[model samples]
Target chain A: MSKHTSMALRRPSRLSPDRLRVVVPILALLAMLVATGFLQPRVMSYFGFTLLLRYSLPLLFATMAQLCILVVGDIDLGIGPFVSLVNCIVASWLADQPWLCGIALVGAIFAYAAMGAFIQYRRLPSIVVTLGFSFIWLGAALLVRPTPGGTVPDWLIAATGFRTPLVPMPALLAIVVAFIAHHLIMRTAYGTVLRGIGSNAAAVERAGWSLLVGRALLYGAAGFCGVLAGLTLSGLNTTGDPWVGAQYTLLSIAGAIIGGAEFSGGIVSPIGAVFGAMIMLLSSSLLSFLNISTDWQLSLQGGLLTLVLALRTLSVWVGK
Target chain B: MKQIKFASASALALLMALGCHAAKADDASALKDTSKSGIALSNSYAGNTWRQQMLRVWQAAAQQAIDGHIIAKTKIVNADASAPQQASQIENLILEGWNSIVLDAASPTALNGSIEDACKQGITVVVFDSLATAPCAYKVAYDYVEAGRIPARFIVQQLHGKGNVLVVRGMPGTQVDVDEFQGAQEVFKENPGIKVVGTVNGQWTESVANKEVAGILPSLPKVDAVIGQGGDSVGTYQAFKAAGRPIPLITLGTRQEELALWEKLDKATPGGYATEASSSVPGVSSIAFWVAQQIVAGRKVPNVVKVSLLQISKADLATWLKVTPVGAVASPVYSKEWTIDLLKSIAANTAPPPSPGPTQNK
Candidate 1:
C-alpha cells in the first residue's frame, strides 16, 4: 500500500518513463473520442460503447500475455497462435467437456513454461524458439477444427456478452483486468524481482532469485492470459476460427510497446498497456468510420502508430 | 479453259469436304478414347465451407465421369491460398499428363504463365470461380458483378427505388466486393432516389458482418433496405433482430442460417417482405468438371462461359432449404446430365452469355 501510494506521488523527475509511457496512448485515445463524437454523434450512446469495444476483449487479453513477456525482457512470437489454439480448444471441446478442456489448457500453459525453461537452459534465442512454437500451435488448432464453425459454451458467451446498464462490458472488464494485473505485476514482491531481473539479471542472481523459475512463471502467466483472451474472443463471437487471432501477435507487441514497455527495459505499466491496446483498436475503427479506402487504411494505421511512437521517443529525450 | 477451271474448282471443293469428314472422324476417335482422358483439379484454397462444398461437388462429378468411362482418373491439389503455390501445382499437373486441368485460381493474373504453359503442352485448362485472365485458358466463372446487381436491383424494386439503404459489403478491396459494389453503385446511380445511407465492410464472414452492423445500427437512420453480397444476410438479419428494428428487405447468401432465417421470415412476415437470396453456388465447380470433359472429348470449347447467379425468391426459399442441411451450405444440385448439357450448349456456342441487367424477382 505504501509502495502504491509512493508510485502515485512520484514526480516526473523521478519517474519520467512511467508517465511518458501512457501519455501518447491516452492522447491518441482522446483524439479518437473527439473524432468519433464529431463524425458520428450516436456512437456516444451506451450501445456505441458496446459496439466499439465488443471485439476488444481478445486484444486486451493478448496485450496482457505480451505484457508478461515484456516485463521479463523476452517476447512471445507465438502469442497469436497460442490464443488461436485456445479458441479452437474452447470452441470444440470446452463446451462439451469442460474438465478435459481445462486440463488441455493447463497442458498448454505448461508447454509455454517449459519453452521458457528450455530457452533459458539452452541459451537459445527466444525469437526463433517462439516462432517455431507458433507453427506448432497453428497446426494443433487446424487439426482440431479445420474451418471456423463451433459453438461457444452458453455460460462463457453470457458472461462476455453481458452489458451493464450504463458502463459497457469492455470498460468493466478492462478495469478488472488492469486492477488484477497491476497487483500481480506491480504490487507484488515477485514482480519487483521480475523487473529487477529484467534490468540487471546479475544483481537479481546475486540476490538469490532463480532466473529459470522467474522466466517460467512469467511465461506461465502469459499462457494463462492467452487462454483467457482466446476464451473471451470465442465468447464474444460464439465461434472460432483458427486464423482469427493472427493479427493479434503484432498488435500485442505494438500495444505493449505503445503502452510504455520497452524491448529490453523493464518498463511496463498495466493500465498503460490496456489504454494502448484500446488506442490501437480504436484507430482501426476510426479509419473505417472516416471512409478511408482499404488499401490506404493499413498504411494510415502504420503512419499513426509511427507518429505516436515518435512522440513518445521525443518526449523521453526531452525529459532526460 | 473454262471447262478446266470449273472442273478444278469442283475437285478442290470435293477435297475440302473430304478434309472435313476426316476431321470429324478424328474427333469421333478422340471421343471414343475417353478412358484415356484425365482431368485434374488445381484448387487455390479450401479454407471455408463453400470451398468444402465445392470440393465435394467436384469429387462427385469426377467419380461419375470415372464410372461412365468419360475420364480415367481425377487428381486434386489445393495450394492453401498461395498464388505461386497454385501456379506450381498447375505446372506439376500439366507435367503429370492430365488431359485437362480445372483450376480455381488465387489471382486473375498470377496463374497466367502456368496456365499458358499447360495449354502449350496440349492440355485444356479450364479456370473457374476465381478465374485466371489468360486467353489460353477457358474461364467458367459466375459474373460476380451480376451477382451483386441482382440484390441491389431487387432492393430497388422492393423499395420502389426511393429509400435509405445500407450496404453491407464483403472484405474491403477484394475483387468480389469491388465488382459487387460497382454493380450496386451502377443500379443506385440509375435510380437517384435510392440513397445509400451508410456502408460497412462485412469481411465476407457472418460474425464480422454481425458485429459491424450492430456497431453502426444506432448511428444509421431508419434503413428501408439492405444490399449485401453473399455470406452476410444472416449477420444483417441478426443485427436488425438484436436492435429490435423492423427487418428490411435483405439479400440472402448461401449459408443455411440465412436460408433458415428467410424461411422463418417468409412465414412470420406478411407478403413475405419482398426478400430474395442469390449467390454463385459452390456446386458450380461440377460445371467446370463437365466443361473439362468436353474439352477432353475433342469438342471445340469457347474461350469463356459466364454462369449467372442463382436468385432464390422468397416463395422458392423452402425448395432450396429442403436440400440444404442445417448449418451446411446451400449449394446447387447439378446432376451429371445437367452438367453435360450445359457444357454442350456452351461448347456449341448456342447458349448466349447472360447480359448484366436488372434481375426480375419473379
Candidate 2:
C-alpha cells in the first residue's frame, strides 16, 4: 500500500469529538455488561440505568462536590462528615414538616456554607477539622433523630430519581452542573486561580490570589453539594439514619479517583466524577445481583479504579 | 489596632452586659447545688431503641426520690452510633462538671479512657448494652453473649442441628458484634450441623439487611432460616420479597417485629410481634436504671444484666403482652424516670446477685 493512501485512510473519522469521547466509555461499559449478561442475564437488568442512577446520585453529588475542592488542588476530608452532619440535622428537625421543607433546607445549606468558610479561614488540614466537625455535627444530629424510621416526602424524591423518555433527570442535572463547572473552571479567573494554586500554591501566592479564599470558596461549594446529596437521600428515605452519611465518605473519594480525576490540579472535572460514580454504582449493583461477596465488591471496585487510571494514563500518552 | 480596640470595648460592654446574666447563672447553679446533681448519658443508637429509650428512661428514673435523696437533674448526650463522637462528648461534659455518667457506649474499647477519666474525677460511671474496657462502678444491661446463646440454641434445635443458616449481624467492630457473634459462634462450633452460610453487616437497619440478602440470593443455596442480629430482620424479610423466595425466618429484638414477619409469611394476620418493640427497649432501660442506681449510691453493680429474650411467632402474637409499659402515644413509652430509680435500687443493694427469673415468654 502506498504511504499517502495509508495516511489518508488513517485520517480522523466523521464522529464529533465530544460524541467520540462519550461513546468510548459507553461502549466499554456495554461490552462489560454483555459479558456479565452471558454469565447471568438477570444481573444485567437489576443494574440498568435507572437502578444505577438510584444508587449513584448521592455519591455523584458527593464527588461533584469534591470536584470543587479537587479543582483547587486541595482535599476536603470534611465533606464526608458534612454530608452526615447535615443529614442528621434534616432527619431530626425538618423530618416531619414537609411544607416548611424548602425554607428549612435552604437555611441549612447556608449554615453548611459558613462552616466550610470557617475551615478555609482556619487553614487547618481538612481531614482533621472535618473529622472533628463530623463528630460535633453527628452528635448534634443524633440528639434529634435517635432512631432510624422515617420516610422522605414524595415530590423531592420524584424530582431527583425520575428518568423517562431518555433523559435521567439526575444525569441531566449532573450534565448541567458539569457544564457550568466546566465553564467556571476553564473560563473564569477563579478557575484559573484554582489551577494555579493546585499546581503550585507558592507560585499562585506570588500571583496575588489568596489560597485561603480559593480553598474556602471551593470547599464551601463542595460542602453545599454534599449537603444537597444528603438532603436528597433524606428525601428518598424521609427518615434520617445518622450513619447514612458516614458511608459516602469513602465512596465519594473512590468515585472521584475512579472517574479519572488526577491527583494534580489540572486533571479533575465534575462530569468525569459523575460518570465515575455511575460506573462504580452500576458495577456494585451488578455484583450484588451476581451475588458477589462484600469483600469481593470492594476488591473489584479497587481493581476497576486501577484499570480506569491506567486507561486514562494511556489515553494521555497516546494523544500526546 | 482599631480592630483590637473595637473588639475589646465590645468585649468590655459585653462583659458588663453579661455580669447581669452571670447573676442568673450563679443563682441557677446555687439552686441546683444541694438538690439536683448532674448526670450524663452516653450511648450508641444501634437502631436499637434502648439507648434512645435511655433518654426517656433516665428522666423517669430521676423523678423517683430514693430515701429522700433528691435526684436533682439529668443531661442526655448521645453519639447515635459513632465511637469517636461519644468520647469527645464525655470529655466536654466532664469539663462542664457532670460527675455521674451512664453509658450505652458505642464501643467497649472506645469508652475505656473516658471511663477511667470519669473515675479519676470522682465521677461515678455506669455502663450497659456494652461495657467499658474496664469494669464500671456498676454495669447493667443484658449479657449480650448469653442473649445470643439463648436465640442460637433455639434456632439450632429448629434447624435440627444442621442447615444453611445466614447470620445477619449488627455494626462491625462493636462490642455487640464481638460478644453476640462470639457466643453464637461458640454454640455453632459445638453443633457441626449449623453452618454459617453467609454473614453480612446490616448495620442494624432493615433496609440494609434486605439489600444484603438480595445481593446474596443468587449465590445462596436454599437456606433453612436467617438469624439477623438486631433490627435488620425486617429487611431480610424484604429481601425475601425482592428475591421471590422464602424460608422459615427467626430474628430477634421485639416481639411485634417477629410476629409481623410471621404474619407476613403465614398470610394470616397483621404483623405484630407483641414482645420485641414493646418490651426490648424498656427492659434494657430498666436494667440501665438499675446500673445507674449502683453508681449514685456508691455501691457495687454487677458486670452484666441478662434479659430472657422471647421468640414470638404468629401463634403467640394474639396474646402478646407489650413489655414496654403503655404511655400516651404508644403508652408503653420507655421513660427515663425508670432508669434513675432503678439505678438507686441496684446501688443500695450490696447483697449477692439474685438468681435470674424464669424465661418469661409473653
lDDT of 1 by residue, B237-337 (tens): 89999999999888888678888887788789976656777888777788898877877776676688777777676556677677777766777656545
Interface RMSD of each: 18.6, 18.1
Alpha-carbon shift of residue A150 in model 1 (angstroms):
37
How many steric clashes between backbone atoms does each model show?
A: 0, 45
lDDT of each: 0.79, 0.60
- TM-score for chain A, prediction 2: 0.78
RMSD of 1: 23.4
Q: Tens-digit lDDT track for model 2 on A147-176?
A: 543445566556654655666566677677
lDDT, candidate 1, residue A158? Answer: 82
lDDT tens digits, residue span A1-320, model 1: 99876876664455475666766677767888899667766567775666567667888999999999888788889999888899889988987888999999999999989998888788787889999999999999998878665768789978876878779989898889989988988899999899887788889989999989988888888998899898887775566667767778888988877777888847788888998888777775565456453346447767866876787778778866
In candidate 1, stretches whose alpha carbon ends up further than 4 angstroms from where it belongs are A1-124, A128-320, B1-32, B335-362
Clash pairs for candidate 1: none
TM-scores of the candidates are: 0.51, 0.44
